[model samples]
Target: MAAEAQGRAPDRGEGRPLRWRRRRSLGLTLLALGLMLLAGWGAFTVSVQRRTEQLRAESNHQLDLFAAAVQGMVRRLEPMPATVQLSTEVQALLRQPGDAARVQAASSYLRRLNAHLGGMQLFVQDQRGIVLAASDPALVGDDLSFRPYFLEALSGRVGRHFAIGVRDGVPGYYVSHPIHDGAKVVGVAVLKIGLEPVDEAWGMLGAPALLADSNQVVILSSRPEWTYTALAELPLERKVDLQVTRLYGDHRITRFPLQVDLRVDEDSQIVEGVLPAGLGASGAQGRSAASRGMLVLGRTLDGTDWRLLMFADLRPVRQQAAQDSLLAGVSAGFVLLLMLLVNQRRRIVQQKLQLNAELEEKVTARTQALSETNARLRKEVREREQAEHTLREAQDELVHAGKMAALGQLATGITHELTQPLGAIRTLSGNAVAFMQRGQLDAVSGNLAIMARLAEQMGAIIEPLKGFARKSKAQPQAARLATAVHNALFLYHQRIRNEQVTVHDATADSPLAAWCDPNRLEQVLINLIGNALDAMREQPQRALWIDAAAQDGRVALRVRDQGPGLDPALRDRVFEPFFSTKSAGGGLGLGLAISRDIAREAGGELEADNHPDGGACFTLWLPPVPHDAVP
Candidate 1:
């Protein structure tokens, strides 16, 4: 445009300006025509997207309301089964589960409830899972053990299940309540509900809808013929199970006629991808290909796996979209006409303006641009000052981090140096005491030889840290039960004799074994034996017994002492951390707590109970290694 104007300005001098004006008018007309077309296309695209979103939202809302109505109707009937279970006659009948005469009266009452409650089949089952009485007399004495509702109620819980009925061969939803004889579950009271009424109500609505169970079978639907249809293909195992149960009688499980896209979830995309051509011409109640494209919205019913599905016809939506496109096109055309008329009038006015007027407009625009550039330069200077201040603060943080790193290094060196010697001293001292009790003076002197190095340990704090750390890569293997018990006694032999404790070992001669960490198991025995010695300090008998035996594919090690038994109120809380009965300063109250954790980590249990004869008994149960699995 600049080259063209420059050439024309020199050729025309200042006399012939009409040709330049005509050229400008032609360029503006073509530009406006292209813009009008682009605007029309954009309007159509936006209208289609908006319509799709509105349809999706509207369908979802309708499905949600339908699901709520269905769930509410079922919930209103929940109280009936609970109320029937509380009747004295029902309870007495269930208590005498074998009495056929007693069930007759119950069956009569159930029949009356069915008549009054608008087509609900009520029944009762005994603990043996046999239907003792039912609203339908023929169902009495039938076995319903395989039903989920019966199984759940027999386990002492309220049961809710939706299944095709095995006994009556009809699809129904079941709700059951357990009938308790004192604290024991005696029988279950069940109510089988037919949702034909909900289906009928849905039929009156404009759109088609259905309610499907977890197995994807339509139990209630707006279209009556659609009932018992499966939404998706069934696995081989599930199909066989249903067939054996005869849940739907002779009706074969088959897929619904509607096709769905697995790649996308939105209703618009799913409807757009349906292939009616695959189902052939006589598919889905004889609906044509265009009519078969349906927008589907599904919602799961609360507290159950059942789903409510709503389908909208895509043909009507497409027709509405077409109308919207035509309206946008007409509007775009009107805008273009208005613009053309305004531009034509402006063209006439511009032709009358002098050349000096155009020069002045250009000068005004250049001045405004220079002022904006100056304002931006000032903002940059302010930003640079703030950045320098931030850099100084970061330098101070770096210095503080350096000091912390040096301090951490010093602490690590101190801890590693101190703990090594303390562990050696503790081990040597235990071995020395064991040798002395055996009357081996030479071995005791040999252990004393380590005393020169033990003094180097000095005094340091031991911290029981509970934080992230590298885990040991040890695997549990079978270990001797007798070895762990004797190790604990050997370590504390001198203390036992000094306290005047008479210790008896039942596992000393017996060959018993367990699957656990040997070191951890010994630690558990030591804590228990030490606690027993302290408990029996004031007792006259002063007896401690260690018993170990194998039973029920496991090893049981028990430690009993003739001391004050555990308090009945504290039995449940004895294994809790820092809950020792010992006086303050007697111990840190962590011995039993730590021992319990060790036993559990080795796949064993540590339990404390009061012995019947009069002392506290602590038992450790460990898993046993199979004879063939021994390494």
Candidate 2:
């Protein structure tokens, strides 16, 4: 009957009896496969949940160990400065200023103290507001009468922390203690330490570290590249609320109490929850290599309205669980098939062959589609690379144009600078012409001499412009750093005087030289000094200082002003092209960017930092010219 049915199927162009049996076998196989898949999924879910818990626990322990190690190091270093400040010998020097022996002894002690503290800057000031001595000799005679520390110590205050003077040429904190002469205030001892150590310590803690006041004004951060000092300047309430919300969402902690709430009148409660483990719907949309399963831990810093967070990937544990479930599902399917093999072996073998043929056809179609997609992707990549190159060239052109525009604006000032000599030359020529017309030979000779002197004066003004106009590829020259600074100052002297900005060149008398393009170095100076003047435009205390020195085989020049310092948020971006905060039409914002490029081309660099007392300082550092390279 089976053969008869098969023959009829072939006659009707339907199929054979074997084909029908294969189809029936395939239906049973599919049902069993579905059951096995469901079982595997169920097992995977439970295993993943348990493994996630384990990973969370392990990650929390690791974070705890990391935090402990960092805290220990910080605590150990903290006491060293306090110990030095409280030394009996340091107190003796503060009480007796005229005792040279004692002052010298204290100075030596202070130097040793600073060295022990890993090169921290230290200061000792008398109660009378006089800087009695310093670890650095340059600061020995500096008056601290206006400093907050001196004033506080004179009032008999105990140890206090304050922010003062830019340390290491950067803004930082000062921990100070009052020196007592019996019951009366005698003087104050202060320690200046860089925040870099704190930042490094935080890195060792396995997370980014930040120090903020109760108000959340990021006073210091280990990740300054990401966080700005302006964060501290924001309204305390806004900073606290926003940061608290983010912290809760990122960490899975259930409950937290806000400490040192500077914003609200009362403390606030915080709660955090963890989402379920799965292939997150939102996560799957992205192309990131990161897995879905993760655990987050968080805790609030004691004595501050700040939170610390840690995150760990749980993908490895989840993957192992999934693999185990897959193996179990395959094993169960094989066992079921074995039990059915006796009755359905022939049918099952035919079904397997038919299924294999369909799968192969689908794979071939998918491969062709993938090849087309890959070709399209390659074409898009090529187009993007071309677009990027074009954009870069356009940016370079814009920068070059902006520089030219700035130079053009300076033309008026340059002309004004030259007018004095030009006017004298005209007068001398007129006199010479009149003498020659009157046939007064001797008088013409005198005028000609005068003309010569005036010609030389005109050359002085033109010389700078000529140097500035020269467009040669950067070449190393044995140039005097001090001379370059002075020349740059001379070009801007009129503007500085008009703006009532004071110029103080603390460069040494002896020439400090470097291997650099003289014109380019001067251009950098011009840009920095000009910016310093502009910064003080609205300030009553307008002062500019151009200080230079040679240190560690480099020539360092610092241009500082009493103007409002750079907004911390904009500091890092200041050197990026066309990133201007100045009013429209005020500048194209290429000055600093170009200056930095020029510095780099000269084998140097430019850096900016906030002054401790509140100002901006731009520093240019260039390698000292090798004696052998000198022309």
Candidate 3:
């Protein structure tokens, strides 16, 4: 019995070593599997982060396009409201709202203008906010005194607002401009543009977007149900204000079911939401990807207290990340199993040696490649510098040549101007001498006076030529833009008169100033005006319009000609050096090129485009100088 006990004890001790080894092996396998799981989670997190950023960038780009379209529409309509100031009927109606004849005339005029403007409703309201006349007969006599836009215009300002129409139960964007009787505001002219077109356009873009006002109420949306819904919770005060203003009319404003599950950043978020019935897609079956979840991005509209929000579907991004995570986990498991089955220690050592050797070889090869690339880059940089220097020298020569060409072109007109004055002076002097000989004192004095006036006239014609021919140092400072426009016109007076062109000068109506060299500004204006005149040379009813206005910290002067508009394909190439549409020997085509350079030197830009009405328009934009700074 004692011997059997001793044999069992030795056997048990032997089995202890096997058990210990088994347990150790099991622990290592578990650790590897755990690490693999962690790696999978890490991959998933990283992928989600990357994909979210990509989605954000894409949404931002789309937002920019949408914002641009919105702003363009508003800008197109904004000018329409101000055009009412030019209507005599509108002016007459405002002066005497009680006059039935004037009211009918204004209404008829507005109706015609509205038809021409694609059905935008136009109305004129008196100082008392009583609608005297409107393109839509039903809108007349409507009391709009309580409206914010009316109050804004009455305070002598341009008013812009978006609201639901009280009469028609439709949404519209209103633009109002004051009718000024000298310095006093007499009445308001308003244009109401339907938002359905904008909404429809947005819907066609596929991506979901909404436009929210300052109170966080959606005014315009690609989704109809989203309109009038609050993007966030509206405070009591805001709700009261909306009710009082009746901005959204009788529409019940409620909080949208948007829950922010994650805040990506200040301008981005992951939200779960569904739009209202009117804004949501009708007859939709189950929960769509947008309804399930979406990424939201927001941007403030330019020049307005409104925000544009875009929604991007997030399902694809999440699905892709999940698939990548699963693949990573499976790959890790497969690699782990192979390593365990092979003599893990030996295989790991071999892989480490091989990896280190390959790394060293790759490092050496990359160093050589980078060194060669660096040398090539340095050579290319030198070549580029030389090329730029040569181009600059050539540009300078071209500028000089352009100035000479302009002088040559003006020579004909200058000669005609000078000859007339010279001939008159000669005749007057001869007559003065004849009168002196006859001893008619009073007649001789009159002849001498006339001769002196003729001599001064000749000097006036010669002075501009001398000033224009002589190059002046570039010194950008405060200068009157209106003055530059007038000076350019003075240079083209002879050509303008010869062609019988009707000139409309709006710049003379206001004091506009810009930061630019007076000589360079005049030169640019002269080039623009010359181009306009050339464009109108063959046109029967020639006319030119020059307008200047200060906007967004810049002064813009536009020269428009009544001629065949520029060809679309040629518009972009118009400023290219040596590019021209002129007849042979008519111009060197360096005028616009040199003018553009001068504009840039003075921190401005020159733009060319075909006006919407009819003609080529050249606009020069310069940094504005404050009214007080104008010397």
Candidate 4:
């Protein structure tokens, strides 16, 4: 009986050990599964992030290309309006809107020009915005005064706007330039380019494209249905404006149904929502097609107040991440199974070595792939940066070209100045020779002195140019304001006489001095005087007034011209680089801009305003030199 009880007790003890081993094995298996799931989740997250980043980079590149193409297309016709404004027939038409001969000639000229330009519409508008002549004669006498482009052009600026044609209903971009009869904006020359070419350009894009204006109104889009839609809600005032302008030709503006699901970056976003139907989709299919994850990217078009938007499918990125996660899970589960299958110490070590080898090979392959991708991305970035550097260099070269043109104009003035002196010197020498032959010693001597003085005057004129050409000193020196004004007037004495302009130099004897580079101060004075001369060229009463005063350690020199005072609207922009109110070839508009910069460099300022009596007045303020520092 004792032996039988002992055997049963041993069996029970063995059963307890067996049950504990089974429970321990189950816990280990469960832990392995959990570890596999964690690895898969981590892989999925990493893959999603990596792919999203790649998509963002790719979308941005695409957007850049798209914006550049659109800009190139738009700029192709920008010069046409300005060129047409210079046409004699067009100007004549503006001058005589009621003259049939003038209107017919202008229309014929525009017709030929429009045909030459290929698909661009040309028209002329009077200051009242009445179309006096057009390539399409039917458009003649059309009242387009309500158009935004017309209003902008009437204000003496190069105007740009996009809208549908009121008559033809065709979408087009309008570029308008003011036709100046002297200082007055007599009329406008308008060039309207049809969007058919731009629309045809969409064939190159694989995704949807949208171009929105400053008001967030989508003016151009790949999908026809999306056209004329607002990217956001329109303000009541804006709506009223669009209504009055008839910008879209009676097209009702509505908000596009697009919702941003996430912001990936400043210029990238994730969009998810059911937008309006695409090309041909309808009903349930249309909704399904529109309802999808999309990567939206945007960029501003250079040189215009327009934004471009593009979309890419996010399904591919999500799908790739899912596949990667599944692969990671399979790999981890296979490794766990191998570990469980091998129990012997030697076999366990061998299995671990094999698993590690597989993992290392996979990790090495992934790392190589990522490195290759990074290398490609870096190469692209470097290439883009290099391209940008080249563009900047080109811009600098253009600026230098403009400066050279300005120099040529100055040289022309210099030639005129020298011609007069040369002629006088030749006449004086001939007279001197006659006097010497006649035994008139005093007359000959007097002629010689006069000749010498003329030569010296010529030298004085040439000397300013030489100094202006030479590099300036590092620091400003004391300069006599009166002397600078005198030299500037001496350079333009011929023009002043030719134009019969009366000059009033209140500063000719002033004792004011300024702390500034002498050559630069002279240059500023020359520019101010030249501008004053130009302003009074067509005035009935041609007069210039120059004055100087000292106050609070500063000297203010003012140049006032009798011509139509600086257009009240253009007063603030007179000093902007390349913003010229002059006709083509008059100048690049850099004179005032350069003068302003020179003044600021010398610790001073330049400003423009209308004088109380009525004329354009430019004031140059410079740091005053102490009486003791005067040289």
Question: Which model scores highest in TM-score?
Answer: 3
Residue runs of model 1 more than 4 Å from their true location after superposition: 1-37, 166-168, 261-282, 285-293, 341-631
Tens-digit lDDT string for candidate 4 (160-237): 888788888888889889989899999989999877767888756678877778778889888777778887779999
Candidate 1 per-residue lDDT over residues 110-148, each given as its tens digit = 899878986568898888778888899988888888787
Candidate 2, superposed: residue stretches over 4 Å from native: 1-473
Ranking by lDDT: 4, 3, 1, 2
TM-score ranking from best to worst? 3, 4, 1, 2
- Please provide the root mean square deviation of candidate 2 (C-alpha atoms, Å): 25.3
In model 2, what are the clashing residue pairs, if there are any?
A: 217-232
Give me the displacement of residue 163 in model 3, in angstroms: 0.8
Residue runs of model 4 more than 4 Å from their true location after superposition: 1-19, 261-290, 341-631
- Candidate 1: the clashing residue pairs are none
* Per-residue lDDT over 12-46 for candidate 2, one digit per residue giving the tens place of the 0 to 100 score: 66556668879988998898899789778887888
The C-alpha TM-scores of every prediction are 0.45, 0.34, 0.50, 0.50
lDDT of 2 at 28: 86
TM-score, prediction 2 = 0.34
Worst 10 residues of 2 by lDDT: 252-261
lDDT of all predictions = 0.72, 0.64, 0.77, 0.80
